[model samples]
Target: MGGGGMGGGMGGGGMGGGGPPPDGLRLQYKAANTTADDIQIKPHFKIVNDTQDNVPLSDLTIRYWFTRDGGANFIYNCDFAPFNCIYTAGTFGAATGVKADMYVEISFMPDAGVLVTGDTTGEIQARLHTQNFTLVNQTSDYSFDPTKVDFEEWTKVTLYSKGVLVWGNEP
Candidate 1:
């Protein structure tokens, strides 16, 4: 799927959950597969450089939060990422919350390159599967959107620049 970006200084209500986007790098998302039940969860991402300065991919991290079905272990895959899907890595972290108990943290290798001002990091198509092949209940995910068919500015999935929150909110 193709990606779209958010320009600098657009103000509005909280994106998908809470917190208006801060002016800097912006994260956009869309669900390739919105089914409530699936063998795997697909979450596509694209990054927009809202600031005037260039932002390196090495300094950024994206987190897609969701709940784990039981004690299921997950395996991550980057089906497509402009810089090279193989260079992107996803790891899970145990978290405590009502909507999300786990999150897939996505990080990029240096090969991903930099995003100049007003530029966007095309599409980062990613998905995860349960090791035991269990279906994922995505409708209740903190970052999953069943109605979003196109890339839009989303806050449910968070973005961090050098470990500082520049966009979205945590569950």
Candidate 2:
């Protein structure tokens, strides 16, 4: 027979029918500002975890691949929870000219015991580059596909708590 307790799931304040506590995970992103260097353009997006869970902050690394509309591809690896609020791209050549057809996919091996009822998503302030990006809040089944943010420049992508959407409240 199996050893100790019924092992599986986020296990916190389980649902009414003893199912599972509502998932308290909300991830968000926004850009601080944009800079055009003598060589390239540097734009960054800030990510936040707006929830009451011991959310995964950093240490867990995630690999990302970006495919632009013009079939340009970029690959990089970052932490599941980055210590830095903003994720900055290397550089966009001055003359190359860029298009927004940006599809981004991130994958990582989730670490156990990191997600709880209350945790700091990240210690960062929010910045809204209103002119550059639009915001979208949606739910996911832990699976993701590259999504487009805008048409011309890059996008500020993020993850939102499904629980908040359903309960109309955030703990």
Candidate 3:
């Protein structure tokens, strides 16, 4: 009675995990403030749909990896987002990797809307700071880039589509 054929996996149901979805996506970065020793780590992002087909925003998630500096109650904020920041939520958790013991995971509500071809979810200004407003060093942060004063394609940050790495190289 135990054939063990069908499987539950990454994308779900009977399909096994291969990799992220075929839809090509790029994560753009622009640092609102590049001071690594400052009170906040600002990593501005924009998700570019580089494919021919429209992608649902509900299926996408962006992760900014960093350390909490041994501080608890870290705060995350979306200063601005064109896709309605209200539809976006940020959570922090421990992760397995170098340069980061914790990460800020950005997720969207079901009504986050679809991303059309060659379109972008513009200027998602994400901010992270300690609860006491103390300075947190971002110099070694996996996804923090001080050189990106202007928007450019940044691969340090990771993107997931339906729980798979769709873009960027995780540190």
Residue-by-residue lDDT tens digits, candidate 2, 1-171? 111111222433322333333354434332222221111111223233334434432212111112222223333223233443233222211121122223232222232224444543342332211122322222110111224232122222332221222111111
- TM-score of predicted model 3? 0.86
Count of backbone clashes for each model? 0, 10, 0
Model 1 worst lDDT window (10 residues): 1-10
CA lDDT of each prediction against the hidden true structure:
0.79, 0.26, 0.78
Of candidates 2 and 1, the better by TM-score = 1
Ranking by TM-score: 3, 1, 2
Q: At residue 1, give the lDDT of candidate 1.
A: 20
Q: Compared to the true structure, candidate 1 yields what TM-score?
A: 0.85
Best by lDDT: 1
Please, what are the lDDT tens digits per residue for candidate 3 over residues 81-140?
Answer: 887788887877788788988888887765768788888888898988999998788887
Clashing pairs in 2: 27-159, 52-117, 52-118, 53-117, 53-118, 53-119, 54-116, 57-81, 58-81, 60-80
lDDT score of residue 105 within candidate 1:
85
